[model samples]
Target: MSDIHKHIEESQVTLSELMLPSHANFGGKIHGGYILSLMDQIAFACSSKHSKYYCVTASVDTVNFLNPIEVGELVTLKASINYVGKTSMIVGIRVEAENIHTGVKKHCNSSYFTMVAKDDNGNGMEVPGLILDSKIEIRRFLKSASRLASKKHSKFQETNFEVEKYISELKNHNVIVDYKGYK
Candidate 1:
């Protein structure tokens, strides 16, 4: 943690654009990749603004496309720093699409992007601590922290996992095991 502290509102960013025909996929809806690109850009901007250093995306959490966007719809991405670590920040991004004619909006996606601040040498750098002034901010920070802890736990389990110990359990699943070596 750095000596400096900043509020979450200081680093909030919102980007809106009209979906173009070229951004559509074979099914005639806006492409998921294009929306993901926009989300990445907004996450970078929000994290950089809070950290005051160049940032790189470390990982993106669950991104489920809940709704499809049409070519004429207006897409909006809102990003904010939800949690800050010594050198990394978790950015919460919400994506929505609005029909221009109907003035109706639908949530397209929600994702959490982990970004790390970098120095000129491309090494990780410390970021300012977050000043949680509201219950929502506190909840967001705690949620991000919990998610990080869960991810670490999952990784640890994977590393020490014994396939042979659970091989018999595979019979309960949809998978078909045909290896002759397995008794």
Candidate 2:
């Protein structure tokens, strides 16, 4: 283990479980919240493995459920370190559900979790740098960087919001803005 860095592959974590009836929601499908919990667990495990320190989830960037998970299907979550900052790492997770009888798999969701390493004293600790060894790893690292940049830009836009400028943009979407009583 290099003191300063670790390969992304070395920190990958995969978890798979058979979906049980108890995991389903009132609609009779697996609940999104349950899958998110599993994703968070794998993110913590992967980040801690890479950083060699205790870590906590800073934020979950996105959780887009592409497909619904069915009860009795096998669900798998694969997590890997996408990018690492001084004390933070982005864990990319891919979720898939498989039908056991048919051996068919469908992508359920993809999420990015940001985790920050902490020392025993609960202070932020420096984490090992990521070693990108493959194209996919490099792409993920770039994607994480781009995502962070976009988030910062969005924050700035929100802070200095202009309703007039967005009115034209909102026209293209499913929005109806009445200017008479608008803030």
- State, as a TM-score between 0 and 1, how close model 1 is to the true structure: 0.93
Which 10 successive residues of model 2 have the least lDDT summed? 174-183
TM-score of each: 0.93, 0.88
The CA lDDT of each predicted structure is 0.95, 0.91
Separately for all candidates shown, the number of backbone clashes (residues 3 or more apart, or on different chains) is 0, 0
Q: After superposition, how far is residue 137 of candidate 2 from its true place, in Å?
A: 0.9
Off by over 4 Å in 1: 155-158, 178-183
What's the lDDT of the predicted structure labeled candidate 1? 0.95
